[model samples]
Target: MRSYLSVWRLPSAPVLLVAGFAGRLPSAMVPLALLLMVQQRTGSYAVAGLAAATYGLAMAGMAPVLGRLADRRTPRPVLLAQAAGYPLLLALLVAAVLGGAPTAVVLAASAAAGAATPLVSGVVRALWSRVDPEVRGTAFALDATATELVFVAGPTLVAALTVLAGPAWALGVSGVLAVAGALGVATSAAMRRWVPVPDGPRTSPFATVLTPGLPRVLLSGAALMLGFGALEVAVPAFAEAAGAPGASGLLLALWALGSVAGGLWFGARVVSVSLPRQYRWLLLGVTIGLAPLTAASSPWVLGALLFLGGTAIAPTLTVQNSLVGSIAPAHATTEAFTWLSTMATGASAVGAALGGALIEGPAGVTGSLLLAVAGAAVAVLVTLVPGRRPTRGRAPEPVAA
Candidate 1:
């Protein structure tokens, strides 16, 4: 195996880890905060889903642009700009909610915020690749596990602040954390120790999106994310419909709990599996896992099933990241990764709205949850296509070795 662990031995690893954690804090905070904010202010679960969807859509639409800028321009400046602007945007959003500005306005702002998303995943992943190749997998695994942990805490943190101070305070705190995180990373010497790698022609990012294998990965990831968006919407609706809406948090926590477990399990395995095969199996498993949710009846049942069904979440994500690295050219890795994030974010936004609508209508929460299953299925289906599942890159050494 190549020396992926070399980055850890580098003098700069400590700073990178700190910065990565700081940057990741916002990932967990944003969705939960947005959902809680809209839920509280509008008192409509569907509207809350819409807000969360809007935020995701923005991240999808804008990630590539920001990432492209990072590749061609300076990552530090991009990071700095996002660090400064994101907080202001959140403040505006908070004000709009407080002033009871119409839902349309809130949605628009949410979309803008989403679009202006800083491409955090792209940035961080790019940072890791600069580490020695032998350690990249371990580094990726470690980061993915940490991110799963963030999801576990991010929502809880937002919920607590909302209960204690108000959702407004939660939003404010996330913005502050994001700004601080971005600035901290951008300023760190380790953050600037980036190695430039591009996978495509020096063309517009639009051209980059058109790259062959890249789009398939993006679409597959998008489909999986769409399923996630549906679950995000359905859990809240399901809880409310069951006469225990407040238990939605517990349900989601259970889901994240499963993810944390899965991430831990995957992290411990030193596998040499092919990235595409890993993806195919992971997607299939995730879809199969979600099948049980279509029959969920109560909060307790939903929580239990969600936790069980969530077992594949982190593994699928880990494989997806590995595939992205395998396929993209060295120079454009960041941009490519950003494109995946963008696509997923967009798909998630739309999926959430679709799920919300389904729950609000006759299909109800049961049908809405089926959307998650469908999402997993789509990812599996994509892989089943001829020539869609080949391992890219130099083909990662057997992940099982």
Candidate 2:
């Protein structure tokens, strides 16, 4: 509590937190809203799924490029430009979808819209790194928890809007939120004064990727999210199999609730371990927590296990954020954080695909759960790979390109 209060006391923290949440709402809302809208218009889940996937892939593919631009140019111009462009692109997408456009046109519009999605998540995270070092961990923890809440809240809001006025209305609201949130952050005092760290002799295009200890952190984070992606699928399937399909949402929400609780608790404490060691142990905790799910024969049992397992999720993310901030070159911090988002997005897609296939096989939901555990275990192993220790308390000096 004291730690969180310390974070909240920072001058720009409230504006950043609120605006960041609003700006990131679209990330949660758009995919489900777009899927429902396209499916309603096209009357095919297959087409809708493809469009949604295309949108996500486009966003993931373009985010690092935009982040790098922000790293060089500062986030104000980048966010301001995106704040204007994203809503317009989203409007175009909605128009194309509702105006009875062809499938190709709709898909292209979805891709364009996603490519223009605001860079709020990365920018906000990078800004957290600029906060005083003593409370940076708590700030990251709060950010991670807020991100989880966004996914939960975004879907609920979309469902409400969809029920009231249909998916297009839901999507339009998402665009509004994106624009307002991005503009708010872009015009903030902190963002207005932000300047990129001056480039060093070794600051090349690949400096972020080549930073010692960063590759392992990124790889482990991806593997952890891979587990999460599978769990997302497996938990719902578990509910459906138990003859309580409607309980799926409740189960997943409980899982997120547990994560929020864990994050708040972890953030308030003082950690005694190095970030790398803490990262490994947290990954291990995820793996151990997941291993018992194979034995869950009922939704009640599965939900309980999921709630317990989810406790590790945000703490792990907090450590990952801290490690990235500490090890990445100051010149490329935004890009480094964006790469984390990219890896998580891409790996989660793969995990979801793999889980979908495994769920249909003889192994069924059990196989998916095992895959989830295996993914986390692999992450633990990745952290043990011999590498330079991540420097704490400050950004590392740039390595040779």
Give per-model TM-scores: 0.85, 0.95
137: Cα error in model 2, Å = 0.8
After superposition on all C-alphas, the RMSD of every candidate to the true structure, in Å, is: 4.3, 3.2
Candidate 1 lDDT by residue in tens digits, 193-269? 55444344556537665555666777888898888989998988878878888898888889988987887677556
Residue 159's lDDT within candidate 2 is 86
* lDDT of candidate 1 at residue 153, scale 0 to 100: 81
What number of clashing residue pairs does each candidate have, in the order they appear? Answer: 27, 0
How far is 105's C-alpha from truth in model 1 (Å)? 5.9
